[model samples]
Target: MKKIAQFFLKPTVPVVTINGQITEKSVIELEKNLKDIRVSTAKALAVVVNSPGGSPTQSKKMVDLIHNFAHDNHLTVYTFAEDLAASAGFQVLISGDKVFADQQSTLGSIGSITNFMNVKELILNQGIEIRSVTTNPASVTNQSMFKDVPEELRHVYENMLQSQHKKFIDLVEEQRGSKIKVPKEKRGSLLYNGDVFNGKQALEYGLIDSIGRVQDVMKEEFPKADVVFPQKPSISGKFMEYAKLYNLFQTIYQK
Candidate 1:
């Protein structure tokens, strides 16, 4: 009698969580999981994303990598939003072969942003005088946040933002397969101002396809396939669990 060949199978859908700031590590882990799925006995892939977006560079890299992987493997990639998916998160969604959002899930606000806080007032309140000398006159103004911002740097920043804004619009147009209409006045950096929309509203605005749960879609598409979660114990969850245990230990010691 011939020996039977044992076949191992893997889940097609891998839910990746992007709760906090997106980092290089998050990108690496996502790539690793996708690679594993490619070699495994899985026909397709799905990523359940819940993110507020992060570094623009990292977000772009992640989106490109996912797009390439799906194309090479001929795998259908689906992205299902949970709770929230905005900014860089939206970028990743565009890479999906099919994008979905729940009835209550929030999406949209496709844009880029950078934030900086001025500490000059705090130092001045402390009676601290800070002085700096620069070889270039422009450098002096650039180095200090206390003084009014220089027009040149402001123009440069605005230009960079405008370019990014255009790229975002282009991506949306490509993914949606239609031109999105936005007023000329609202076309700049104000594109993503942390606005959240329900599924119906999102569809009206051409932000997403349909309003349905992930499980329902899976059952309809892959009736016989099993769902899988690639990475376990999200960073935030692990941290909270550890904190709870530590608190328990402290209470016991005090008693």
Candidate 2:
């Protein structure tokens, strides 16, 4: 009787994996997969994320894409943070209607960062000098890696980072809302100060809805639905994977 019921239901849930850095190429591929899912008979979408986070702009696009798809199709978005989901990755994680993570998964690190290096001394030691002329030398002078950032220019950078940081905080507050345990006034000093939490702690802080593997949680959330994951790699892809492993082993033995 149960088997007959399952056969008649025919529920399917399409899964999308967002791995590694969130770059232009990865975002484009994600959009393509979502487009395919948009037309499918599936009623829900599962996103598996394992990323240390990269490219804030790309991450924004990814979050927007998933949110738009969920809204348009009226499908539930289930996100699972595997291994690591920090910074921009966490931004994407919150896009899900329900989020899950492994007990040891690393999450959070909500903040903005910009790095600059002044190589003037290093080049000077090598007795090499680089010179260029531009229409607005004063405006571009402190912005160059060869020159130290002036106090005024530093303020500009700080303002930019603050703007970005505020955006991240707003998104979190909008999604998690009362789920966040941190007090309102102290949320800035506590939650949004670029700190990472393990899955257990993340659950306590209400960053994730639950702590479970994607497969297990999907079964519990949508029991009758058949979870359809992405296709396996082609023959050439498998060969490349093996070749990469072989190279790693050779390097390790040599070392």
Candidate 1 per-residue lDDT, tens place, 1-255, comes to 011101323235544545555679879877777665522435566777788888778888888877787677667888878888877787777567788888788777676666545688888899988776666645424546665556766666678787887787777767774533455456444344546677677766666766766778877787766666664457796587557656766887899
Q: Which model scores highest in lDDT? A: 2
Candidate 2 lDDT by residue in tens digits, 180-244: 87679887787889999999999988888988887887788788877887554578965875576
Could you say which candidate leads in TM-score? 2
Backbone clash total for model 2 is 0
TM-score of each: 0.74, 0.82
- Each candidate structure's count of clashing pairs: 0, 0
